[model samples]
Target: MSSFDNTHITALTDLINKAVQDIIAEYASAGRAVPSLDTLESGLFQVPEETPARLTKAIQIVEAACAQLSCTVAPPGSVMINKSLEHEEPACLLVVTEARIADLLLDKPEGLPASELASRSGLDTRKLTRILRLLATKHCFKEVKPGVFANNRLSMKLLSSDTVSSIVCLLTDESLRASAYLNETLTDPSERDGGIPFIRATGYPFFDYHKTRQGLKKGERFPRAMVGWGDVTGKGLLAKVYPWTSQPANTTICDVGGGNGHVTMNLMKAHPHIKVVVQDQPQVIEMAQKFWAKEYPGAMEKERVQFIPFDFFKDAAVQGCDFYYIRSILRDWPDTESELILKNVRQAMKQGSRVIIHDTVLRDAVRTPESSSNASVHHDVAPEPLLPNYGVARVRTYELDMTMMNLLNSQMRTLPEFIELGKRCGLRFEKLYEVGETDLVEFSPI
Candidate 1:
């Protein structure tokens, strides 16, 4: 097989392995004997005529065991039990909630008792414990014992006081507001006014709202979360994706809609020879200046970077920049809005200038089941397809896409969709650079 074919097979195989492992773990945790490999292989080949009665019995047994163990395994009444609601949890909620906890822990640094934590959060002790317990399962925190929770690496990243905490807050709030009206929004497809999207849900566009609410004060933790996320991930791009080493000295790089200039700051730090213009709204620019002054004082004065206030939807003010960098900005917009943003960037560029887009390009694939006796046994006794096309991978991507749709009415673009969007904006799409899991596409003026 060709390398591409081999790669696909390997990815598929790994996914299957992981799925199997998860199944085995679930069954074992429930105190059930695993099924034989022969039974599993036979089940894979011969589709079951009905939902396997044995599998149902096994789940019941497991659920009972879980109850006896007093474990918080999802109950039949839990939202996860309903196939439809399984993915409704907002991604931003996860980010923001974790960030809030992180912030609370960071303030104390030495860790607070459960009572103190509840008091500080303005949430009841019981409610806080339940939430923390759930988060602990995901490693966001560690339950020191029955009643207390401590911050972990993931939770630390989300702490509100951390520079990145703002991004989490921003995303979480935006997600929550949008999710509140998801059902209504979906029922009315023809509605031009996105009722609960970031722009409509908040009564104004995100940037405008941010203008009234200053950073760290406006409770706009989501934007800050996004900026922090970008900063952490942008470094990976610099080290592995962007061709920073090849770029000429005295190069002017424009960061379009670059909120708070965190990404630009990192880029300039990596490539000191390159000059940068951090562009955003007037209010955001003012905030960005404060951030730059505080975080990167002498570097800005040295002429390595300057903050410029310009709306990307308007005429481009980024003229003569060798690279127009937009990271994690376009994903929150629909095709029409994305086109406008790209058009502005195109107009600002010289012939050879590159438009570097750093965003997640989700793909359709299934997760593999792991190689374990429990997994093999569960597969043998389980019904065919388990959850139909509703495996872990599909559920994850679909849920995230749904959240984006509800909040911004935006859809995650496939590679081809991205190319088409670029074409619509009169930019020629070039090769894609893979940085970790993100796809960084380079474009030039057509």
Candidate 2:
């Protein structure tokens, strides 16, 4: 009946306390206090420099150790049940987002009664109270009083206005539905003809499904969701992490399969000297045109941006650009199709041309000789008593890996996988850039 012995518990306790001290010190050094979870604004992590190496490591250790410690002490059945029901919290979140509860409570810092909130959102009062209470217990929204609900720092992110909400809805609705069919898709032998779980759930592959009349109505939210995808995955820091300023003036940076051209827009805004070519399907190109026009009219006026409708699977990317950037594109396809896409970009490369792929580069839970060899980018592993991949701290990337598989029968590649994929396309691994949430793998002609 006893859990991890004294030594194990002590190790975890020490790790947590050490991490907490490190975090507190970092805040003190910055002349700032550790942010309150209730405050409705950006926290320390918003400022990249504020979350430097020491602070980041500490935060990871704290997250992993605390969760591990809890699991170590908790009943096995209790933990298993909690993990099994994880989907329910997000389902509640979907309800809150769909009802615009966050937006309604935006002005009500003190909070709103559950009955009033339910009436405004057109939901049953008792049901709404239960949902809000569940979310509150999860630290999303807060139950300020006996039956009153309010927006907290976390709930503010669910505000209908934020781009994060788009991705949230997509994941909770379409992706969630697709995920439900994962077991069926994996088991059914007849499902092998490019019929991913998403297709099984909707009777069409992701793109084709989105093109249908019903899909079209829902797909309108998708472009913005793609934009929100960038925001959620730390694409805003892409320009800063990479050496955009080092490139020559007017250097053309081609954004291959760039939906809404969010990455290039960030680059152009940060380093306006660079010219950009945003390439995708004709429909996406059309969307990119409007997006660029509305978001950065001056760039469109000055011809600093170009919209090129090109399918990577069938056509070469814009030739001879200094950098051909592909953000979160390859993860949507299996290795065979991913290679074809890369080969097209490979064909378009000139002597100095480089391909920069921005996606989740997964790390193994334990170190290996192969992982060591492919270590172009240094990923910090957690110390003893924590999962090597930082367990709950880095679970989002692993969850996204599952999401890719469920939706497209694809995966987020490991460094070794990425290196091999590039080599197959006649490209050599150059270097890897680790932005907080994702990794950028750079390649050049073989």
Candidate 3:
């Protein structure tokens, strides 16, 4: 479609969304039951049992009214598609505001009214007012009055003061920036530079910049974020997938490239029988010790888990561990770098040991279109045809693949790609486990 057509479609979609929101609001105001999907699909505000002809005419009227709006009323699947594509302005706004609000909420846990927030953020009050209104509508914040805002459950979850939220802040911004340069980065050879990739348009590789940021210092927001994500994913993976409890009593689980020992700690907590060793860069290991040592107290004296300051890329120091668990680390590098890391990891593993690769994997699926019940129908026009299902996960994976291409020179590996890479390093690919649609592929020394 032409740029004008795209703009027109976006405008029309926005109008329909606004109309739908208004209809729902009206229903809320009236304390009446909201109309059902069947009612919407039939194009009649209310079903008429007795007057079939009038019902048909009303349906025509409703369809016509929607048609007059000059755009397709997106189907349920299309809503998800729109979200995945980040096509809607509101979606992007939501993401940006969520990040900013999370930072603000962490810095000022007491929270701020919209006026005060606008003042502190140096944002225009009028624009901030509009944005907050949108956020409040989506339950991101609670609106006490016309211009006042307060933290709601959703907003609180984004706070950097917490571990997961902090990591979310770091990753989400990097994701956005990478996405912004996706097209150019993919098409241009000059985009790739010393593992930095296309995001250099912003002037530095993400890791280099991330390392330099004051927020990333030991005991600062970034490590806490990493710890938070590690805690969440580690616990979830251990409970759902890994058989940590089934391992032998003498087993030593090495978390290679483990950050802040979050995963190691969680694994230790879950499988008390398993001794854990976490290895990473010297700086990260030092911070990891300080954070976990303080939190666990005498557990370090007891040696529940040992933090080893060694880079997995440099040498395989923590060898002969029963299981080598690497979570979400390999996906950050390209095939060549990943091969190098795997080779190093392989040198550390024993004959019977397993290497667990845990990260997000994509699947292919198609979208289907349907009409919106929330839209106001004009009496005279015909409704537009619904859009076709473009496979969603495929699109998302490609987009993310391009994003990683730009930001870290990494790519999301397909099942076959994983197998191929493993073969090159003399590691045989083993069974794959499903972790909420993401495949956790196992590798062993061939």
Candidate 4:
């Protein structure tokens, strides 16, 4: 390699080595080994309540540097080809999840023949093998022996019992379907309304489409999908990071546009002293009532939690709650609608009341503190030889931004963009709490 190439590789390798050492030290201190990837009970997937910030930062460095090093050393043509055909992986994953192949293999530790899998899943033997083979290449499943397959740690995540399977299906089904029309929607001059891609593909906007008969069926699966999403996205860690225990007992939290109240349920479960008022659409609140009833019946019976129908765009959230928590809500709409929602929340805020918007804040491949005036919170920027946004380590945020575009023509905002939006709604940015993959941005009434 040339001197320039050597320099880049040295830096990237150094970053990787340091991060690995940090991770090893953490596990060693805890008297635990780093979780294995081969078994379903590895324990890595179950995120602990308190994830050390150092450990999270170390993992981010390892992911960013490794991907950067790969791109730097790999053949340019091969990299381009891999990127071009990347969509095929999700397609294969869809087949595995939809077929309930993981669940079928739950009791079969030894593995099963491709023919047996095909017989059970009702798929052609050869084609089914091809799909499994493709996914196995990605380490999502494993070929324990030639022509025999079994679920690995990754594949086990797709079991029908896992909420993540619902998310996998949602992405591969509706999100992928709408993504096919993204190009056409952008190019078509007559595609005026936002969500044109989803509308063109499904004949209705995201919310409206979900209300139709077909949408209702998909909607039934969506809440479970959100729970799965929260798990994978480290959203459940919000309860741990946000210091809910510091709030006085019985302090009220209004979950604005909180879907099915899964995130709030996590909070309530962790800190039983805090009360919650879960607000969403009528149908969603109805479902949420049933969810709370089954999960924590006393929360409803004692009036510690209330499920109320709310239209944030047209009406304010429950008035004067200690904290207004909105998770994964604003990203589904464009700026105009997002501003309206914030304004309404602002309308109901008391002097000490605060609004917490929990979502991913997008980062660029390169950034500097001086890049934006609204860069009030300091974010960790990757070192040289790695993309500043930590590349694939932070890929989920970018993927979610695209999902929003595919479904609703919305986006994950940058810090500056979020601040601007809040300013428009008479809310000022208070502070930002970095939980893990997502963030909790606090805002107070201006």
Task: Please give each candidate's TM-score.
Answer: 0.62, 0.90, 0.64, 0.90
TM-score of candidate 2 on Cα atoms, chains taken together: 0.90
**Candidate that beats the other on TM-score, 3 or 4, i.e. the better one:** 4
What is candidate 4's lDDT per residue for 92-119, written digit by digit as tens?
8888798899998897888899899999
Better of 2 and 3 by lDDT: 2
Clashes by residue pair, model 4: none
Segments of candidate 4 deviating more than 4 angstroms: 1-5, 30-32, 48-51, 192-195, 207-217, 370-378
TM-score of 3: 0.64
For each candidate, what is the lDDT? 0.62, 0.86, 0.60, 0.85
Please give, for residues 213-315, the per-residue lDDT of candidate 1 as tens digits: 5423554455555546555443435533467878788888888888888777877777787888999999999999999899988777886778888887886
Q: Using alpha carbons, what is the TM-score of model 1? A: 0.62
Task: List where candidate 2 sits over 4 angstroms from the true fold.
Answer: 1-5, 47-53, 192-195, 211-217, 293-304, 369-375
Clash totals for all candidate models:
34, 0, 6, 0
Question: Candidate 1 at residue 32, lDDT?
Answer: 55
State residue 114's C-alpha deviation in candidate 3, in Å: 4.0
**What 10-residue stretch in candidate 4 is worst by lDDT?**
42-51
